[model samples]
Target: MSTLAIDKRTLRQDTWWLEPMLVVLGLGAFAVYSTWAALQNGNYYAAPYLSPFYSPCLAINCEHVSVPLFGSWYNWSPAILILWIPGGFRLTCYYYRKAYYRSFFWSPPACAVRDAASGYSGETRFPFILQNIHRYFFWASLPILAFLWWDAIIAFNFGGSFGIGLGTLVLIANAALLSLYSFSCHSCRHLCGGGLNSFKTAPGRYKAWGIITKLNEKHMQIAWTSLVWVGLTDVYVRLLAHGVIQDLRFI
Candidate 1:
């Protein structure tokens, strides 16, 4: 079995590097925006509307916060407490594993491309071994998704009055997008369909599995859409909270 002795890095003809490079820029920009927004602490709450980045505001300093579970002792942004669940989920996601591995790690940046590293250890190492807990992260994210939905519902309550506003719609859309991304996860598919030997035994599970499978097919698109929408939702709330913009009321 003699292979070609070509010494070049890759024989790919098309622009394979373009995809990974774009991924780098997209994820990098998101990291910058999310970091800045999370640390601001202020301008995350605007009355009936709260930024998705700081929902379930746990700190006493959080404005209009319902829970205040962390209390005043816990200073800094409350987003620090909440973001980690979703962050860990996305970090350990199967799709994201491929994305960052190619873009950030540059390990076989594209199809048929040479790996950046000389050797391969896979995810058996200390930090990479942690990826195995992705299913746990998925479980943890379920409650967070519930909270986001609660936030969207509360956005309709304006000081005890039912009102519809642009911010309310934004929060609703944000929650919906995140729901799509979360439910479309591979872990969710496994939970719905895995470990089943006979689909005839559990028709309900089979139906749910079919639905999740359809969603999973578009997981990448949903993931990116949800990520961008969350950032935008935060910006919308920040502007309104800072008095830079006023909420457009429809009802």
Candidate 2:
């Protein structure tokens, strides 16, 4: 029998509820934690700088942004807000697609399944088929990263006022996060080398792509590392804003 067949047999024999349940639990925990953290740091409501940029309409009022954990307070943003959406998107990435589908979608093990069981064989659908959206997201995120880098610069200019002046550590963390997210994207990998049929024909492009592939191979590791560090960077900013964290400057 093939390896996929063995995996399918094992999956069939395994308990289905455990993986799905764990997915729910994990998502729930992250939602709760993120909501609580935002509320605690006064981010649930619009920041002073953000208010002038966008007005709160009745339907999209910021006050409606709250997650129901213990008692539902006006938590500021919905649990499914933009901050949390990225997590869901990343969880569904091509590299993570199989692991997450099995856990969240209860997909059968593809390696063991034969004849249209590899998870890719399906009627094309919207949103679920929206994994292709990452290509757009990859390009879009670059501009956001540029703004983040600018924010870091402003933080330095103000000498870290109102917690806006992020420290060097935070700056480094931000750069690392941007690098990991940008470099690990599937679109970037494809642009690097996946599209090329023959390296000998396009030696220059092939060499450049070869370098990018090395980076892409470690994409998952970079993704997780950057995720953790970016969260910490936000925490640092919040702590400084609230006067709970201090920036140590020398010279």
TM-score of every model versus the real structure: 0.96, 0.62
Those runs of model 1 whose alpha carbons end farther than 4 Å from true positions after fitting are 1-5
Best model number under TM-score: 1
For all candidates, the clash counts are 0, 7
Model 2 quality (TM-score): 0.62
The list of candidate 2 runs beyond 4 A from truth reads 1-31, 35-92, 108-123, 160-166
In terms of lDDT, the best-performing candidate is 1
Tens-digit lDDT track of model 2 for 96-189: 5655565555464343433324456442686577676766666655654654565444444443354432365466566657667676777787
Clashing residue pairs in candidate 2 are 4-111, 4-112, 5-112, 65-76, 65-77, 155-165, 160-165
| Candidate 2 positional error at 4, Å | 19
RMSDs, each prediction? 1.6, 8.3
lDDT of each: 0.90, 0.52
